[model samples]
Target: MSERFLTHQVENQPPSLLPYDAFSTDLPLREALAREGGGWAQAQVQAYGVLAGGEMMALGVQANENRPTFKPVDHYGHRIDEVEFHPAYHRLMELGTQHGVSGFAWRHADSEGAHVARAALMYLHYQADQGTSCPLTMTYACVPALQQAPELARDWLPRIVSTDYDGSHRLAWLKAGNTIGMGMTEKQGGSDVRSNTTRATPIGDGLYELVGHKWFFSAPMCDAFLVLAQAEAGLTCFLLPRFAPDGSLNAVRIQRLKNKLGDWSNASSEVEFQGAVAWRVGDEGRGVATILQMVALTRQDCLIGSAALMRQALVQAWHHVRHRRAFGRTLSEQPLMRNVIADLALESEAATALTFRVARAIDAGAFDEGEAALARVITALGKYWVCKRATPFVNEAQECLGGIGYVEDSPLPRLLRQAPLNSIWEGSGNIQCLDVLRALQREPACRAAYFRELLAARGGHVLLDAEILRLETLLGGDPTQLEGQSRLLAERMTLALQAALLIRHGDAAIADSFCQSRLGHQHGLAFGTLPAAAPTAHLLERAWPA
Candidate 1:
């Protein structure tokens, strides 16, 4: 059965699906992040699924096309001119354990908290097949739909929440993972989210009717949507299942998928819901808070993904320079190339440090109101800097490759194109900056505590002196002081201070001072410092001089 399914390709072509093979490689921390996912991010899904035993489930299923026969190429080709179609393909097979390979379902009950883990695995498959980028919309839709019809949550959560593959095969295409990205963006809403124009009114029976269009949904063709709509009480969340039980498109229509620079593997679409059947997720007025929990998770995922991308770029650069020769020796031996590689390595490590630290904080439940706001702010900064640093590293790596890098076939250009999308997706850098500012304003005391943590981390005396000097310098009214008024400047200042504190106090041992210095330079960039030839001198003189 597994062989037959493995032989069954998408259409007549063999499967291009790569199994998660490098789960146990022990590379340097930063290098591992890049090679494992950052550089080859699309492959991370398989790794995640394998970790949760999803490969076993695939193995258990009989070889057959049980779902709808919709070709993604037909839908995508209309929008994208260039589409790569692999010739030979192979589906995901059994998980190879130390004992031997086994079907996915056989190992389903093996892991601790296996049920939840299984749901997560299923979710990933669904996301991969439908669209990977639009979990936000699907989550939003599911919460409300389940709340209104509690039975749906009870029935569906067990099957689909943990694993993306367990849902009804008939409605597989409409599940969270199957759709085009969910559309939540409105022309005027701008992430404030409370200002959406879409409306839902209670009709007859248990269904409420929906009407409105979303401007930017990641997976618009998803099985169901959790939409935000104006109601009699206030802005509320509605779960609009996109298809009937028989697997037909209901009232939702896909307007189009955006031509994006990154995450092109998934469709980012605009959609219209016309009298779509929906059930409420929670109390109408409490939609914002409920949605935010999901948004926070998405933000963390973005940060992790960005950090992974940075790691990938750095590793690729290292490998390129190590093997590629120029002049008389390897590019890595060149003084300038060495410096560039060192700098890239440092930034990647710093980004990873920050990301993992935040993840631990989240896991520890340290994200109180104040910490939550700051975490988001810091994560935004991390996402922005990791990707921002990665782009140049990729370009430099390509430069090392010279003409070969310029060609599309090289991974350098692909990394360069894909890395920038991280900064834009989740939330734009500017939006993150604004969010930080808002957070600071809302919790001045907590903001102050956060800064104190920063100051203490940078050596309290040193930061105190620097802050006083900075204030004194600004009293003379330098033109650059105008930048101090910008939200990003203030937020990044807080981040720098906090990072310095974390380094001083955090348990992670410093492996490379060269990496640390490069991180300092990157931090300066995050704070919008002017480019300088000597990064150490610039950090002392401009960023946090005592």
Candidate 2:
């Protein structure tokens, strides 16, 4: 009966990808974790991988399909300034918190590779749902900023690190756990927080009342936000909570939830602070410096988030090609298609390798000043390059699936929409490049750390050696003249870093393809345009073993 009614049967369509082991099957991720000293967290990573690839993914669809809604007032006309989310969104947050996406690094601060392990956790959770990652990332990032004020840290650290997820809108002190948000940019200044007009008036006991607007108030539902405003001295950092000390709702007004390009499951708002009581976190006029600690960690997640998108999109495309057939063979068996998949695989693995290496650097930085400098410079350049590549990379993976990939039913479109957000959110490409330049020009230790890394991988590949030399030559130029070419400089440094990681720690096939296609510029401008010597079959198998 069904056959008679059907116009045509679905034949070549591949089944949806789910219930797979996101961690176990990822050879590069597993290898990176082991190499980066996160081996102690293997079992935990594996468990979260299963959840991320399975039920959490299903919940991600629900959360995004039913986006968060702005509930500015209660039924009785009380201004609530709240954002209402789908149940699935809360569930995703719960799973993420339980798995330490919000607090792993701090919780295991003394452990080796704690940040690396935490980075891996966020990487997996991001694949499940990109939107929910906003709050998760901020909660983890807020720790260092809070520590600037011992009183604030003492009051907030426990809740921030709590494994439990409390979505209650009550006072943070009353909750078992809490999430933190950030509001830095104003309508007048995007990244230039020093231009922020938000004003903070002094009150007793080191508290102040903030009155101003934030054009991009991220994750407004969080219990509190770390915001910037002008104090008597100058621009200052403050912790503004939703509820004031006296149990009254702070006058933080949510103007409207941003109708963003993607990240529908999360709520970003335009907010006006009307005498919102806040506590100063650091020295007055050092707001930029104080919040930058949080920004650095968030930028790391931006890299991880972008890399996760590449990997997830690659997995979707790779799964489709293996199952869907055309021209008398599976798409994966076609030579051109194989080249594209392998090229994507190379990009994905290279991104993963570089990100994890940076995470390791972060872990090491906890004890070593040299490593700290390396982490700072690398995070800037890595964030710049990896995030810039995400949109194009996802679109290329989409091309591998042709029209089906463009359709909403496939994950590629969502991935593509989410891709550019990372590049734009924490700081745009130009910002990252400028940061890299600043590091090189002003921070001698940073420059030394960067070069030390490159020299360690010297002679790994001739192309790599040449690329390193070029980077050195570029750096040798007058610092004043490099501003216009900073983007190119950042891109070159990032490619060199990725190539070095792949050559030294990644799979040989993947490394060879990356060095040839990316470093040597031996391939076309698009994915799948690998050189003749590229091992397409081996690369595909290494990406996601048959």
Q: What's the lDDT for candidate 1?
A: 0.47
RMSD of each: 11.1, 1.1
The digit string of per-residue lDDT tens for model 2 on 1-546 reads 768787986789888778899998788888889999999999999999999999999999899999889988899999988888999999999999999999988999999999999999999999999998999999999999899999989989999998999887899899999999999999988988789999999989888999999999999999999999999999999999989999999999999999989998899999999999999999999998999999999999999999999999999989999999998999988888888888898888889988998999888997899999999999998899999999999999999889988998877888988999999988899999999999889999999999898888888789999988888888998888999999999988998888888888746777777888898899888887999899887878778875
Q: How well does candidate 1 score on lDDT at residue 414?
A: 55
Which portions of model 1 show Cα errors greater than 4 Å?
1-152, 164-169, 172-181, 188-192, 204-206, 245-248, 366-374, 452-484, 494-498, 505-546
Residue ranges of candidate 2 with Cα displaced over 4 Å: 2-6
TM-score of 1: 0.66
Winner by lDDT: 2
Total backbone collisions for each predicted model: 42, 1
**46-118, model 1: which lDDT tens digit per residue?**
3654542334323212111121122333554542112121111013211121111111222333322221222
C-alpha root-mean-square deviation, candidate 1: 11.1
